[model samples]
Target: MEAFWAAAVGIVWGLPLVILLAGAGVWFMLLSRAAPLRHAGHALAILSGRYERRDAPGEISHFRALSAALSGTIGMGNIAGVAIAIAMGGSGAVFWMWVAGALGMATKFFTCTLSCLYRKPDSQGVMQGGPMYYIEVGLGPRFRPLAMLFAACAMVGCLGVFQSNQLAGLMQAQWSVPAPLTGLLAMTAVGYVVLGGSVRVGRFAGLVVPLMCLLYLGGGLLVIADHAERVPAVLRAIVLGAFDVDAGIGGAAGLTVKEILVTGVRRAVFSNEAGLGTEALAHGAAQTDEPVREGLVAMLGPFIDTHLVCTMTALVILTSGVSPQAAGVVTTAQAFEASLPGLGAGLVSAIFAAFALTTMITYAYYSVKCAKYLFGERRGGAFVWIYLVLIPIAALWTPTTTVNIIDTAYALMVIPNMTATLLLAPRVLVAMRDYFARQEG
Candidate 1:
């Protein structure tokens, strides 16, 4: 199963798919004139609870929605994923990560705008929205297959096994906590929140996201400051590495520039999920009818997660005096251990637990919604119990295997998602223009 999944990742995530994903981002950024970037301040205001409507049609506040989305994107990917990128593609991979983050903002803007533009109520009469609703409703019922495909892919893609595997790996390595024990705890915690659905997940994320991000950032800054002098050289490696044709490191030597680009973009996509359409699922539940508003808000996910959190993790790993090894979460824990000595492992473990738990629950929200789309709320309800069972099972898998499954599932989702977004780009353009005009007026 692991080898099959790995093979599937290579075949599906080839150069053409990388170009399609990154190129779509570039195209959306250019087409929108970087509108999301320019309106970021406004987006911040909206996120700050300034634009909320109590009687709005959606289920959660903008803050909770964004938090929920951020939790999923900002988890294991920001740490383990970034470390993996550096270990494989060299420090230069961080450069492509920035490119991916920038382009992702535009992708988030367009896809999420369509999310709100065509949202409809589910059987529960909740105003649910996502790639599925927008793809079918906005593109017409004839595109139902594409919508179905997105939902079906989402069920597997959002399982978040990588998060479990990496976090469980760190715990097992550092504290000798058994993976099964860690998985049981995770299943209980996640199931408690997830059983309550998106509202509960959103609330959990809203609280945990801010605190965990701060904790992780605070710890990261201390390590970076301790090795402050090495910062310049590490940054240099990241920049120059971005353009080198043979930029790989360790066992990944002889890699081409294309390989580096693919690695960076792929990791960044996994980290912040710019064009993966999962961003839309969270934002679609925000308590507002304005499509452009949510798009603008969703644009912040890549920026905060990829640019800020992932960059911090990258710098920490590079500057911590730890060897640039490919041990995923264990390597990260070592980096923290290098600086803080007696306190490193414990601190990093806490941070990872916070990050990974929030992500697992948020992803539960995404998967459950997709299940509802594919199987309806009744039978879909069964997916939660099934999802809970998978947490412990996933914790037993190797990180490579878990990552491969996620990559393949996400690859499947991107096709239907990007196709729908690209086909409906003109409508989003119109909405963007109108929304801005009203704001200025």
Candidate 2:
């Protein structure tokens, strides 16, 4: 089974997909003329409710939309995923991750802008938006095949199995909580929020995502501060390692430069999910007429997830002098336990659980969108139960199996999304330019 998954992941995440993912981001950057990156300050303003219009045509506030998006992106990927990257690809993987995050910001701006521009109202009168919508509505029904492809893959891709599997494993290892018990608790918490619908998902994410981030980043920063002198060396190693084929704790495992680069990019993409269209599903629900406004707001996700949060995790692992070769959660825990002794690991465990729980809630909303897109509203809404059922099953799966399933699904989903986003980017670019021009006028 492990060998099969290894082969599947290798094929799906091979050079072609890497090029597609990174190439799409570069293409977006050049096409937008870095407009979105330049206007990140403007994005922050929209996120801060500076230009909120509650009466606008959408289901959630910009802040809530962003929080919901972040809730999905900023979880175990930042925790265990980064650990995996360092273990496999070395400190240099961190460098490639930064690269992916920077390009991801631009890619997200394009995708989210299109989401709002091409949004459609559902039978219930709530507006619907996402890659599938833009692929069908913006590009005409000729592109409906791509839209369906994305929806199908997204239903699989957005399951949060990685989050559930990692969190459950950590709980069982650290606290000896049974995996079934952990899954039950997570499913109950997630179901409580998600069963209430998108409004509840948004409200819960808006409240918890920020607190979770603060808790994790705060603890990580403390460890870095304690080893202030080693920070420079760690940063230097990251840069130097990027080109070192013999980098990382697993170097003796015979990884090459290409493998190192790909590892970093894959892990970073897993964390931020910039081109996978999940961010679009969330931002597509923002209350705004100006799609560019939401586009800019959506741009912050990769920065926050991969750049800030993942970087914090990497630095803590490096500075604490922990071996990156250790098991993902164990390495992170050891790093923390080294710095603050008894308190640090416990805090990370609690925070990981919160991260996992919130991630499950947000992805539940994404899964619903995918299901609805495929099965029609009446049948699709009932699919939430299916998502709830997967939580505990995922908790029991080995991490290797869980990650491979998600990664393969993510790869499949990214193909249609990046394809559609590239084709419709001109429309988003036009909308973005006009919105900015109106602001200037």
Local distance difference test, candidate 2: 0.84
- Tens digit per residue, CA lDDT, model 2, 1-441: 888987998899777776777888888989988889898898898889999987899889888898899987776557778877887787888899999888899999999989999988887888999999999999999989999999888888788677788788989988999999988888888889988878898999899888888988898888888889988887888887788754444331567777788888988876787888889998998989889999999999889998889999988877766453554433666777777889988988887777778878888888888899899888998999888888888888756776887778777888888888888887887788788999999
Clashes of 1: 0
Candidate 1: stretches off by over 4 Å: 1-6, 87-90, 160-162, 232-237, 240-262, 321-331, 396-407
- On a 0 to 100 scale, what is the lDDT of residue 129 in model 1? 86
Q: Where does candidate 2 stray beyond 4 Å?
A: 1-7, 87-90, 160-162, 240-263, 322-330, 393-407
RMSD of 1: 3.5
